[model samples]
Target: MESNSSLGTALLPEESTETSFWRKVLDVEEVKKQVLFSLPMILTNAFYYAITLVSVMFAGHLGELELAGATLANSWATVSGFAFMIGLSGALETLCGQGFGAKTYRVLGIYLQASCIISCFFSVIISIIWFYTEPILILLHQEPQIAKKADLYMKYLIPAVFAFGFVQNVLRFLQTQSILMPLVLFSGLPFALHFGIVYTLVHWTGLGFKGASLASSISLWISLILLATYVVCSKKFEHTWGGFSSESFRHIVTNLRLSLPSAAMVCLEYWAFEILVLLAGLMPDAAITTSVIAMCVNTEAIAFNFTYGLSAAASTRVSNELGAENPGRAKTAMAVALKLVVLLALVLVLALVFGHNIWAGFFSDSTLIIKGFASMTPLLAISISVDSFQGVLSGVARGCGWQHLVVVANLVTFYGIGMPIAVLLGFKFKLYAKGLWIGLICGLSSQAATLLLITFRTRWTRIDLSAEREQGTLDSV
Candidate 1:
């Protein structure tokens, strides 16, 4: 008599077949396991979101002008930092996932070190962007008082997270090796330290606002130290010291190569939204308070972080299967990720929708702005769904070394079409806030469609294992 486990195996027939892809994704039992892995990722992002909301609420106490300054400055900081980080980490995803699939442990450590080295270089560049932020604000014709505050915020905030990014890239590299808990568990360390330092020193110390920002910088470095210690003690870097070989430099080069195109694509998309926000601030009634606008954008961002977390996991999963020469598995993994992402997005949107009237109470007590934000629920729903698809496809492309195409597609979709149309609707049509968000929908929607189409039509089966095996070159992704 066949046991139940053996009978189940007999019913399944095979693991690697393409026909089995759907079953692997949908099997009631397997589906539960995949969704379960995603839960920790969701909770981790929820903590990060909580930190942002707390920061905003506290900044709101500093007054509307200060809140606006924080909003604009943090917008720039978040988008630019993301562009720079993704420019490098995309390559780490590809290399480490593939290396793990191939059981090449030494290559994994080399990739990690190279990514950290380049991330340090970028941290310096991002800090300088802050220094020049004042001139850019002036060029945008921001009010002089607001511009001064925004510049201060930019300068102070960018440096706070500089060294911290190196730790994040290392975490992403380790994630591809499938040991993700250390990275996930320790991510909140920086925030805890940041809150304690900023809260205590901001009031107790005489340093004022600059003191608050500096405290965050101190916290960031401490978190970096803690994570770096874990990496060293975990023995994850042992085999990577391959005598300063050219291949090591190539790993750094490879990360940037993949990262640059992806960055260009995403940066263009982000810049469109930034432009709209600026345009909204330029409108007549906007100056009374930008709080309504800030709440709308930032609250939605809390949800967007989930997409990022899942995308990271998807990139590794798809890349691993591809490296193992299991295209069927890769396709299955992407499908599973896509479905799971939308499921998560809808669940989140429902929470946002049901709590719509009450959402802004946490950020501000002004009933008027809360009403304005409640009106924005539908747009938020559509936008989150659009952005979710774009995120997943980017993951799929990264897994397959399709970085260059993503860049080109994003450029055309965002700048070539979406931005032009968005600006026309925003400034010329006189639609104000509604127009700005509508434009965002256009930009992200087009980019998402292009990514989905490109990923779907390609033949995922022809993986070049021997070429990847070569130690000489690693291209953009």
Candidate 2:
């Protein structure tokens, strides 16, 4: 309570006192270290996106038909997977954030177990999805040629998809600890494995799309193994790997309850986009391929990784400060995160707008395809800017544990209003692909605006540090 600077952007009246303007945007000295922490994460995540782009690059080279089929199948896979997995794994962030905040390490182990169980439970559902991949593609009534190609490509990913979902849960647990390097390394392992194996398998075995999928699947399992082994070996807990107790299970259940709202929030957000892809199918071929532009712009995985990493750090910073009972610092941290997000968004816009022509060339050299992508760059830039806010606030919401409210916001903005309009414009008005993207932009704007408002209104609020008691004297750390 001892300071004020006139220049600071005091978001709350209490924080405004004598704080410098820059300080309002961020607590420079304190947040500096966190910026460093976030940088690697951003880079790591960017690498992830880059890897996916590489995958797409390889597939795109296989011919337009292969590219379209692979992209469609992946769209379905990601959306469906997020429906259950993100909701389930989010418990890790909530419980882990609070646990670290309160120095409640013992309880974190319990939450970890719960996250694992929930992830595994959902993995079963995702695995079974392979059985229906062909059926679902057929139901789309796409040309039989496209459907058949998509089904086979999807089948290859089924095994990998199982491992991928579970691995993400493990990564979440690690991220909560703010020990994200392992998660990054572990996440990359699969990409490496996939590329190496896919190249060889596709060339020699003639499995083509199926082989590539299997490569990705094997890579996921490899990643999972590496991370699980790390958790076992890490010194943070002497007996973390010890068998779970009923009390631990109870604590785990509590963590799940806390995280379920977040899961729903994530699922609803992604599912809306999933619906967009389906609706896009109703358009013409040139129209459908036009989506490849959105997908490409949206798929700038590396760029997104940077934002998500920053957001993750923001969540940790907010949760930790709040748990330490320092609301002022929490407010500062949130501001810093928001500022960083906008800054990052600006960078993305510039890159896309100026380099749209060049970027498309790297992705493909087809003049017709290249021209379509270039035309959409400006809109793509806008979408990227808006999404930056969405990504950041999602972390803010997680930090504040407002999972349910976030979902409600997502539904109202994206589904209740955004999707319907996009569909109407696309079909009725004949806006085609442009209509679809406009709809997406509108929805993202909805999410970003609402999340920013929420973060501001809830400024400096405390994260719940409460947790079920540990099983015994063993959790004293």
How far is 213's C-alpha from truth in model 2 (Å)? Answer: 1.3
Off by over 4 Å in 2: 1-25, 48-53, 237-248, 286-294, 297-302, 362-365, 459-463, 467-477
Report the C-alpha lDDT of model 2 over 1-477, residue by residue, as the tens digit: 334554343546655554767665567775685677687677555544444445555665677777666666666766776346756776666656666676766656666776776677777787787557767766865545666666787777767556666666676666666677776687666667667876876667777666655665666678779888888788865533444545555555566665678778887877766666666665677334534543653444345666888788877776666555676776777777877788788887888788878877665656776787776676677777787778878886776677878978998999877888788888889976667668878998988888878777763543444333233322452
* Candidate 2 residue-wise lDDT at 115: 70
How accurate locally, in lDDT, is each candidate? 0.68, 0.68
Worst 10 residues of 2 by lDDT: 465-474
lDDT of 1 by residue, 1-477 (tens): 569888888767565465678665564443564565555555555554454445555555566676666666666665667455645666767777777776676776677777777777888888887788778777887656666766876676676556556756666666677665665566576667667676765567775555545664565566567777777776655653333345566666656766667566666766766666566567775543355666666766777678866776677777887777788877777787788888878887888889988777776666666787787788888888888878878877777778788888988888887777767776799766766677778878889889989988988876554235554543322
Locate the minimum summed-lDDT window of 10 residues in model 1. 468-477
True-structure RMSD, every candidate: 4.6, 6.0
To one decimal, what is the Cα RMSD in angstroms of model 2 from the true structure? 6.0
